[model samples]
Target: MEKLQVLDITGLSFTSLPLSIELLENLKSLCLDQCRLEDVTIIGKLKGLQFLSFLDSTIARLPKEIGGLTELRFLDLTGCTELKVIEPGMLGNLVNLEELYMENSFDQWEAEDKVPRSNASLAELKNMKNLSTLSIAIPHSVNLLRDLPFGKLNMHKIQIGEVWDCLCMHKESRTLELKLDSSYLLLEEWVQKCLQRAQDLHLGGLQDGNDSIHDLCIEDAEAEDGDEIDDDPKVKSCKLRRLTLRNLPMITSFYKRADYPVDLFDAQQLVFLVTSIIMNSVGYSPFAVNEATSLEAITIERCQLIRKVFDLEGLTTNEEVEILSRLRELTLSDLSSLEYIWNKNPQRASCFQNLRTLKVQNCENLRFLFSSSMAKALKQIKEIEIVSCDKMEEIINVQEEELEEAKSADTLNFPILTFLSLEELPNLRTFSYEKYDIHYPSLTRLTISSCPKMMTFSSSERKQQLMRADIGLQQAFGHINSGLSLPVFFNEKVLFPRLEELKLSSMCRLKRIWHNQLPEESFCKLTSFTVELCENLSHVFPSNSMDRLQSLNKIEVVGCPSLEALFEWVCLSSEKRQTPLVLSALKKIKLWNLPRLRDVLKSDRKVNFKSPCLMEVDVRCCHSLPYLFSSATARSLRKLAILEVSVAITYGA
Candidate 1:
């Protein structure tokens, strides 16, 4: 029988089947995901079989005859919980194999006899001369295969990086991968010597057995009591740049004298740094953090110990400052213990000269984030992202009232900030700066999400910041849509000059987008606006202020069910003067998932869009929408797509 080209038997619940799979001589692809099976014995007879997958299936063992399928190229067996072993000599004949995936539980095995039995099990795979890619879960560590005969074959194009029972491969090889849960603790001296040849190195995975971080730290403390150790040799032979360590629990401190000392010398040319769960607790002063002059990006996660290391001031010198100053991208996540960063006195803080991107997430314990002095340190930063930080009482904590009273005193603040993103925060109510001026001339994009408790910016509720324009209360508050009205007791509002994109999503309690405060001049450069999931917003951008929004290009409203109208009022005097002038710049309009929007254009609807400039209009999933740009406006509409929407356009003859 010819092999099957494609066999998709997904979601099949079969416990046993005939071992006749080898009869499919021309099979090119086979998928039995989620099937319940025990063994794959019939697969060996399929001489032309190429691809096979049993992901999420229950299979325990493979027949030794599996090696007979020389034409097989890809094989996957991820999530096969019953798979206990790979039969010995089942893979040596698969010379044409290119990719192999095995998601097995090899880390839980403990018996010493179980180790060799597993080794003897894989004796056939070493003969696959043409194998290019291999992804598998080792029973313990990669060191177990160090003595295997794989030395004869040179791997190319692909490399295996995982957290297994293997010591760091100090070897200089290509195509590298290093996982975070490996067998680094069981590594002997000989294994380390052999790994010194790998070129691309991956440093990841926590140590197993006595490798528990708490235990390792205690052991190191006891051993270091002996004497003053000097001349800690370096591993300079390994030229590694790409490093990834995930879930490294013992990283409370980076170095130790008896175990592993500070290793900045290895991989000095690193360009990327990523780590997860780095809890640095080893309390040693002047910690050995190498200077990565070539470092461009660094990501830190849940590293509680970082607070002490970066606690700068007169304590560190220029060389240390220069190291962090060169970084461009920095992402900090889940560092819950971080209070105040940088020096208490702003003048001594390290400056990030090339740093453009800064992302901070889930730092719940972070209090006053930026001091006026520290804000001056990040002058080069353009993009800033803060999310899920519940304890952020204030950004620049100094009282604004006190600062204005002393404005004559020269104070430096963040003036270069351009892009800002705030999301998933509950307690962040204000971002007021009093002692220092916070201005962003280059500001363009602002994205705010899931901030329920946030009311507004500034303290005095009465004084507005630079807002100078006339806009309708209903329109500005259209972002708040239906039920509740945004209270605008203050006369002035905030101003954004160069902003092009503004996104507000899921503000459930928001009754209005802005207070009915007036501005000096309209936001001239405002172009694109997006409002989503704000159910209460009823009307926005009154027709009178339509001319002031001359640069408005596009507006999108999605999932705002409570909004029944787009615009409520229009000034007749202003309309007659314009002489039916088109909203010449408006390009696109999209309205989706708004169940309350029953009409697009009504006789009383004074809304006018520049249809000549409008290229596309998409109205989808709005079941009640009727009419096409009030018979007065549809003349210039070029393209229209209506999905799951009902439209009624009545032409009055």
Candidate 2:
């Protein structure tokens, strides 16, 4: 047994090491992974022991007798969660040790003069000339020196703080992280060098008292008399990709300037930042954001008290627009205190030209997402989704500071926007306020649900109350005087030229879907339309504008009790003839639970447009109907197949 060279035991249940097993005097490697041990001092007599590991063990203390193993080359105590103390002078006695690991374990390092004379001091590490690899946790930094020379090690992961993000463990070769309060004594020159050497580093709680990290950088920048950080930069913050701030309640933004207290990167880019407190803003940093050209996407979720994402207050230069220009997608969710996605100054323009998609949900305090100028910069925006934001009244808002200025630039155009969905926003009134004309020239699909307060898509020059649609949104036009806002969903100023699908539901105050005859370009390509639980709608389309739906393919309406007909003909004072409603491209139609519906079509004129493509028809519970369709319209239903109804299949055309 004295001649044993190696002994490895993994996941073995044991109370203590066999005292007789100490006979292995020449053991060069001894690994007891996941083995519980009460006393390991019995093996201390093995002076030639070169490697020892008690990985994931429950050992409480490493005895001073461990010093007897002076020839030890490696020691691993990783995952020894209960190990709080190591006898003073024991680690220093390992003069030949080459590697040491104590991470997630012993962190109770005592100062040289502390009463825990039983506990080891970090000073012992100063003399280990052969030590190249190290992993340690010093949860309390009061006992550590500001200059530990950790940068000299080839590979190291040093965590110093009370709490750490465990999800970041074991993912990097060299890392330095801390959740401790800002202490200058712990961030001295050697620590700065260590930060420069880290690969996946995190500097948490970098704030000082009431001051934020941006304040720190601004102060440092001012100290240099507004000069850029020193020219002789090898690496200031390149390797450190992540920064975390915890419990910093007063911070307004992150890294608004390039200058900071420490030298961190040579390649100027920050990948992601995670904060655990009330953050007032995001993307206020110009230097870091401008250098991160490859940053494509950002997702922030489960955060608390974030007021805005971008605060473009004093920024006017094209250089500042580099912040979010390269980002193609941005998603924010579960942020209860989020107020604005982009807080902008309309006079100063920044670019979001490459941002193609944006999604937000569960942000109850968010009232609006973009300012007018911000929307103008979204030239390539293709998709937007907002859900469950109770206070959101507008997707593009005209800030009070820029209201008068916005009037000069009257139109806000989304040139390539294709898909937009606004769901469960009960307080929403309009996409833009009552002034500027918002135009979606390329909009293809639109979905709005539970937005009972939406008076119109845009209220520019056309504002109407729910019951005032018959009195015209504006003064009477021409000889017809056909109240322009009779239907209140859309106005003339806002256009959906290529809209293919529109889904709406649960809109309690909606009495109409569209106003009087819109231009030929509005809703001209609509293919599918769906509505559910809208109690006040009397009809789907007004008879005068029915010819504009030449490309509609499918229609589904359900649970609207006050709905009277699919098409309702309202004659203007000069109109003596009714125009027939034609869904020429419609292939499928489903209607359900509309109790007051008397007819699918109410026009008295003979039908001129034939729906040669009608494939399926479904109707149910419409108690006041007479016949399915007029005899002339039924003759063209050659492709009709699936027909299901709760009441008789009867509807007057």
Q: lDDT: which candidate is best?
A: 2
lDDT of 1 by residue, 222-335 (tens): 112132212223212221232333444445443323343422212211112111111122311222223223334555565543342234334333333333445676776776
Per-model CA lDDT versus the true structure: 0.51, 0.68
TM-scores vs. true structure, each candidate: 0.53, 0.60
All candidates: CA RMSD (Å): 11.6, 9.7
- Candidate 1 has an lDDT of 0.51
Residue runs of model 2 more than 4 Å from their true location after superposition: 1-294, 316-321, 345-349, 407-409, 461-487, 570-582, 606-609, 648-653
Which has the greatest TM-score? 2
